[model samples]
Every structure is written in C-alpha cells, then in structure tokens.
Target: MAVSLFYRTGSNAKEWSGTFEELERKQAKLRRASQRILERHQTQDGLSEDDVQHDLKQQQKLDKSAEKITEYLATHQEKTGIKGKPVKSNITDPDSAKMITSKGTVQGYNGIAINDDKHQIILQAQTWGSVGEQQTLVPVITQLKQQLDKLTKQKQPNEHTIKFTADSGFNSEANLEFMAQSGFDSYIDDNQFRKRNPLFKESETYETEQEKRRLKRSKGRPRLFTSDDFHYDEATQTCRCPAGNQMWRSGVNVNSYSQKYTRFCGYLKDCKVCPLQHQFMRKPSIKTGRQVQFKNDESRQKLSYGDKMKVKIDSPIGRRQYGKRLGAIEPVFGNITVNKGINKFTLRGQEKVNTQWKMYCLVHNIEKLRNSLH
Candidate 1:
C-alpha cells in the first residue's frame, strides 16, 4: 500500500498585542500580590483580629478587578486588519480564514491520500485541523484497514493485510506498536537519521580500516540477551527473554494507539542487578525506582521490530522510496486548497471538524475517480 499524510498551516492573524515586557510586568504584579497574602497569613500570633476582615475585603476586590481585566483582554486583544490590534468583528470562530503555507494552503479541508496496491487509485483520504503529520499515521492506518475490508467484500474473496508507506514524520514508538498490533506491512522511512550523508563523514574512512584489523581477532563472548532474544507471544500472554527466562504478567495495563497491553517483568530478579542494567532498564529514571516495575515482553518485542524497521527505513534506497509520500499525499490537499478555494473552517468543535474533514476526503475521492475514468 502507498501512504501519504496531510497537514494544515496555522492561521497568521494578529490576535494579541502589547510589548513582551509589559505583559511580564502584569504577571509580576499578580505574583507579588499573591505572595503578600501568604506572608500576612504567616505572621506571628495568627492574623490580627482587625487585619483579617480588612485583608479579606482587599483580596476579594483585587481578584474581581483582575478577572475583569482578563476578560477584557480576551475579548478585545487585536483587530485582524491592524498590525497589533484585535479584530473588532463578532466572529470569534478560528476556522474562517483560508489556510496558507510556504507550500500553499488548502481552501477548505487539509488532507492526505493513499493508494492501495490492487489498483493505483485512492484507497484512503483524511483531513485534519493540525499541521503536524506525525499524529496522522494511526488514523490513516485505521481508515486504510476499513477501506480495504470494504473493498475485499465487494471484489476479492481472499483476506489480505494491507501495506502502508510513509516518511519519517510518522515514526514514533507508539506508531510502530500500532503497526505491529494491526499486523500491517509498512515501509515507513526513519526520519531521525535521514539527513546524514555517511560518504562525507571522516569517521567512515577511519572505521573501514579499523574494522579490517578487528576482524583478525577472535570474537568476544555473546551477549546474555539482546532485545531480540525477548519474544512477545500475544496468544499465551507471556514474554520469553533471550536467556530462557519467562517475563510473566505484572499489574496495570497501558492503553496506547487503541491497543491494550498488560506489562510483564522477569521473575528472575538476579538478572535485574546485572551490569547490563542500562540495556535492560533503557531509561535511567526507571532504574532508580523499585527494582521490579511493570515490563511487557510484547512491548519489548515490538520495540525490537521497530528498531529493524528503522534500519530499513534509514537505508538510501528506503529514503528514496519513502520520499514518494510527500508527492502521493500532498496534491490531494492541493486540489482542495487551491482548486476548491476552501481556506478557513466554517465549523467549530472536533466532531464538526472531523465531519468537515470526511466531506473533503469524499470530494477528493470523487476527483480521483473522475480523473481515472477520463
């Protein structure tokens, strides 16, 4: 399966005005007043009888004025037309402007499109309010699966697991876990180290010579357990570590990417105190806590798979293939943003925005169908 993602540019309307220093002064005044109340409360012999009534009234008046000033600032901060003035119009809705970016903005709904392998046609499309592509992976995957299932019922007799591809923005521990749990074959790029050109590095030249010398010596003892040694068996609900130790169920299940998983820790506490704590614990903070904490072999096993996926995505060939993600997904949004003239949102709230996005996806699909037929 081919994958793409969509992002929208944030509105650049001038919504707030006033010097940074001026804003800081207002905040400081609030803090000083708060400290004064605390100090008076802590004075010797408890608060003076007369001071108590006077202080309470003073505090109440100050709080009331502060609340009014905050409301005024929010309601009348800056006008959209002026360089530093709040908009005087009654339109408080944020989604009314045309979305624009360095790459050009979509007029209506910002979205991405994906094509399934069976037919080089749009299989999945979605639009979102935010500009970040990383958050869109799981949702697109879910939509792709649903679309595939629908297509299979209508045409093919056999069940097939869909494959997805995207760039590094979609990389994350959570997204990788989603891919493993869903059992989708994906070739997403490893965005973290993609910018490096190893040929240009001096270290590569030195390492080449050093490796030849090292190969002449005998290999050292094998690691007790690499992360690869642990396997998460979802069916049996257990993690078998490389050393033949079973990491059984521990309390508390963490839900991530719409999947539920119970944590597991090794019963062999002897392994915990080993010098390889860094490898096992991963995070130094976790090591400081009780020696035994919630650990899931499935999560661990999934992590190993994720690492391999990262390696594949980081390869030169992988980067070239994954770069197609931008081309594949972006034009779908361009059609809506540029052709349709849908810049700002007319709706409010997440549910409405999501509905708006779905409509845009439907429109994109219609355009694709038209293009295919002609």
Candidate 2:
C-alpha cells in the first residue's frame, strides 16, 4: 500500500469570544449604563458643591468599573499565558488565541487533522490555541505513530513505509530535519515551492498577486535595495553593492535558531560618496556605511528543506502523489464545518475543545465507513 498520510488545517474559523472582545463589549455597555446613572443624579440647574461631590462619586464608580476590567485582563489566565507576552486574556475562551483569518481577526483554536489516503478516514484530529502551525506537526505525527503502533499490535505489518503530505503552513527547516531523522518520507510545500515550477512562472496569476502584495507592503515608497542587489564573488569572498562599491566581510555569525550568515559592509568613504546611498541604506543619517548579510553554503544546505521539497514536488511522480492530499483531507473539514454546522467551538478549555474536535472527527470517520459499505 502507498500508505499516504495527508494533514491539513481545519476550515472552521472559531468565533472569537475571548476576554478582550468580551471586555470591549462589556465596557461599552457599562459606559452607557454609567452615563444614565450619572444623568439621573445630576441637578437640572447649575451644580452646587454637593452636586459636584455627587458627580465625582458617580465618576469614581465609572473609574472603578474600568479598573476592574483592566485588572481582570491582567490577572486572568495566568497559567496559560498568551503567546509573545501577555496582553489581554480572552474572557470567554482564555485558551484560544486571536488569529488573523482571511475574513478578519478571529479568536479561536486552530484545528488540525491527519487523514488516510485510501478512504479519506481521519486518523487524527487536534485543536491548538497557537496561531503558528510549525509547532503542531510533531505532536500530530506522534499521535498518529501511537495509533499506528496499536494497529500493528492487531496483526497488521508495521514495516510499510509511510509518506506524509502537507501544505506550506506545516513546512519548516526544523520539521524537515525531524522527518529525515525519523525516516518519514514527507512532501511539505515551502512558501516559494510554486515559484520553482515552470508552469507557475508561465502563469501570470501568481506573479500578479505577488506584485500586488509587494506593492501593498511597500506602500508607494520606492523599493529599497535588497540583498539580491549585491553581487558576490565566491573566489574573493567579497560582495559589491549596486553602486559598484566593494564591501569587506564584516563578520560571520549564527542567529538564535542556529542559522549562519556572513555580514558585509562597505567603507564609509565609498558609501558617503555614492549617489545611491539613500536607495541602498536605511541608515544614511548614521556615520556607518551600508551593510548586507549573505547566507553561506552550509547555512543554505542546513535550511533548504523547502528548496529540496520544491524539486521533489515539481516532478510528475511527486505531483501525482501530492494530488491525493487535498481530496483526502479537505472533505472531512467540509463535513465537520459546513455539513455538520460546527462553525464555532462551544467548548472552553483546551482539553474540552480537543475532545469535542475528536468527537466530530469520529462522526466523520463513521460516515465514511457507512458510505464505503453502501
């Protein structure tokens, strides 16, 4: 058996009822109520000192309400802190995160699923509050491994080679390295995988959208000189800026993620004299010259899992195998989100939300089994 495993993000964008959203709604209501309460106590004529004191007490009440809301935001959900420093907790679903969907910002858990290519049966389903999908791959695979082990114990051969297919969201250098170490044959699309194929380049749609996105990000400002604008000399181990000024290798360093890069900087004399100084450098005001970083060959090899996947996925065999992924996974999401009307999760905590998701996946598998038998 080919034993294809397809993984995908679930479709339902959970309706955000987080503490932040709830707080805004509650604050608006409280403001209106407080205003009415203050108006009732206000004197019709010019206010006396007693009237002023009463108004101050009413204002104090409003301040106390706001203070209480702020305290709740600060103190609530201490155990499961929000990612990238705690800002505000979701009052309704503290475990869920505010994710930016195509529609807009949504407070919800990201639902993940793994499916069998044979019958489109869901092998695993999980819910995560993290907006990033990079961290979820290992967990999903671990769960699937356990399930497969159980099946092997039931007399099925465990020697079959398993191949995984997923979209660009699950792609990462770390994940790719993990797959190689674990002996998994996975075809995970990188963000730029499509650009490698001649067909995609021939098509104007990708190019057009890319230009639009680039223009949107640039916001009418002239595009600054990127690293691509510099020419490298492999023999000399030097770089030349777009203005033809030679740059010396400043230093070699590795980032927090262990990615290595070499920095190049032009002489202050050269950069200061260059006409393209403003076009190339972001900091011409400073006395320093222009700087650029180039990824070394070792670094490229270490982090080019996406690039490797591009070569694999561009092949006819690769395309045929990956073609099965969408069909295997998307139908289940459609069934759960669209057909079953599970547009939003009603559950609260992560455990409960996960259980609820599995229940729906179970329903989907049962339906698939029923249909196959018919």
Candidate 3:
C-alpha cells in the first residue's frame, strides 16, 4: 500500500509508448494474425460468433484511432510539437490516461471527490480519463448539484452558502470563474500558493544535484539561484547572468519534454574570481560558471478570473478555509487507498473505474454513519 501497484495483465508502460507509425504497424500485424486464426477456425466450421464480434469491436477501435491520428497530422505536420504529442494508445484500455503518480508513470484514470467539511462525507466521487485534475472541477461540481437536487427532492438554493476548498490541482481561470458564480464560499490555491506564503520562506528545495551538494557545503545557507535568476533575450539571442553579466551560449537545442531551450553559461574569466559565484554554483572542479536555459516567450492573456480568485484566496479567511481542505478531503482518499486497500484499481476504462470509486466512497460514508451511530 505504500507504493503504487500496476496490474500488468492487460498493458504496461512499454505497450503504451509507441508512436503513430509503430501503432499502425503493430495494429496491422495483429489484425493479419488474428484474421489467419479466425480463417483457420472458420475452415473447420468451428468459429464462434461471439469471438468474431469481439474481434470486430477491437478492430473498430483501432480504425477510430487511425482516423483521429490522420486528422491530427492534417493540421499539425510535426509529430513532436508542443501542442500535441505522438498518440499513445492503450489497446487494453483506450480511455485511460498516462498518469504520473507519487510512485511513477501509471496507465490509469484519475479519481476525484468532493467532501463536506463537517462530516468529511463525500458528496460526489468520479474518475476522469485525463491526467490533469484541472479539467475535472467543473464537471464534479455540476454533477454534485444534480445529486443534491435528487437527495433533497428539490433544487438546492442558489445561495446555499456551502464552503468549497480545493487544492492547486483544481485551480484554473475557467474553474475559478465557475467557483465565483457558484454562490458558494470557495478557496482554491494556485500552484505557487505555498511559495507565495511568507511562512514557507525558510523551506528548502534541492531541485538539482548542485543544490544538494551546495546545501551540504553551505550548511543551511539560503537557497542558491536557479533558471529564474537569469534572463534570456529572444530578439538579441543573448542571455544575462544573475549579476547582470553577459553569458556565452554554451549549448543549443537542450530538449526538455516537448519544449526546447537554449543553454547559456557564465564565462570562466568572469566567474572564477566573481564575488557571486554561489549564484551560479556548480562543481568545484568545473571551469565553467553557472549555466541556465530558457525558451522563446509566449504572449500572456489577461485572466480576470485568476486575478480575482488570487485576491480571494490570499485573504486571511482564505488561508483558514483552504487549510481545512487537507483535513476534510485527503482523509477520505487515504481511507480508501490505504485502509480499504483500493490504491490501485482492479478495473480498466473510465466508466467501470468511476463506478468502482463511487462504491468505495459509499463504503466510506457508511463507515462514517456507523461510527456516528456507535
């Protein structure tokens, strides 16, 4: 229960990592091989209609994926572009997303829940096919309203004053806009919430190997400079160090996931005896100064909703309500994932897994009711 467990009977990481071309080749090969088997069975008049139907259903899924990829290629010719990645299809479970959990990469659905503050009772629980929890907020809230209506045998009041607090995963401009109009007291934290809070200023993060070694060398000195400390000029193709010194282009086309960055390093002449060498701290043996990478700038759009929500969540009351989020919502998942031992779902696809998650939530609420009665 401490680690994520993946059921490898249907698919694994390797099976879901193929590119579009590889998927087509493998899919064709499977079809040909299956066709031969079916033909052989039909020759003996022993082929089952049920088996044929299942084969056709799987073929239809493969066909649909091919069409989707073809349409993507029509608009976007490049395979490795940022807007879209090479299609990753799980033949076993096409609806599942490639999720990066606390353990590692998992080919499964993301589960979500809405819990009441008082009783920690789940108002709604569902599973999404996508890895991003940001997209799940609106759908869950909309579904919760319907559930409440059915439970009460009437529509809930427009101004129910229900308090809603969610972690940063559910924070977005659109979601914040929805929360603003939902007639509920809501607090949703941004990803930088902890860092922005003054209380966490002393917290240390060893994000790089150099940082870890530097921390040991400095023995609890303030954190060293990072990529954010430097600046890159796209128009001039230049980089500036933290000390406002010019740095040379040490490397180009440094790949990080789908994005490319240009690396710049401080000159040895300027850095060896520089007073702020710790700013670009590197190995003691290396002659080069600190290094950094940056990509081309993308235009920023005005997010009125985000700004409004930020102010709302940064208020004194916002801190207290959002603080309650962990105590109210997290324990329900912990009880199911750890105590009930449903950390890794046994089922595949969104619908079945969603049903399974709701059942577990139901069991959790039943436990709460039983404990209250006792």
The number of clashing residue pairs in each candidate reads: 15, 4, 0
Best first by TM-score, ranked: 2, 3, 1
> Model 1: per-residue lDDT, tens digit, 186-288?
5666644544434345544224755446534414211223444344656766554322234566655676566554666665453554333343444443323
Model 3 worst lDDT window (10 residues): 1-10
Candidate 3 lDDT over 1-374, as tens digits, reads: 00011221213344644456776676566656656656666675655799767766776676666555455445543233223666465555666666666666778777777778788787777776665677778877888778777877896653324667777777777787666555555667877777655356453433456766876887845445666545455666776543445678977878877778778887777677554465358444165677777764453222355664555555445566678776777777778868987666778776788787778779999999999998
Clashes of 2: 4
Instruction: Show where candidate 1 strays beyond 4 Å.
Output: 2-5, 9-113, 117-121, 127-135, 154-161, 196-306, 315-320, 339-346
- Predicted structure with the largest TM-score when compared to the true one: 2
**Candidate 1, 44: how far from true, in Å?**
44
- Candidate 1 at residue 208, lDDT? 73
- TM-score per prediction, in order, is 0.48, 0.57, 0.56
Cα lDDT, model 1, residue 332: 57
Clashing pairs in 3: none
Q: List the candidate 3 regions with Cα displacement exceeding 4 Å.
A: 1-14, 17-22, 25-87, 158-160, 202-303
lDDT leader: 2
- CA-lDDT, candidates in order: 0.52, 0.65, 0.63
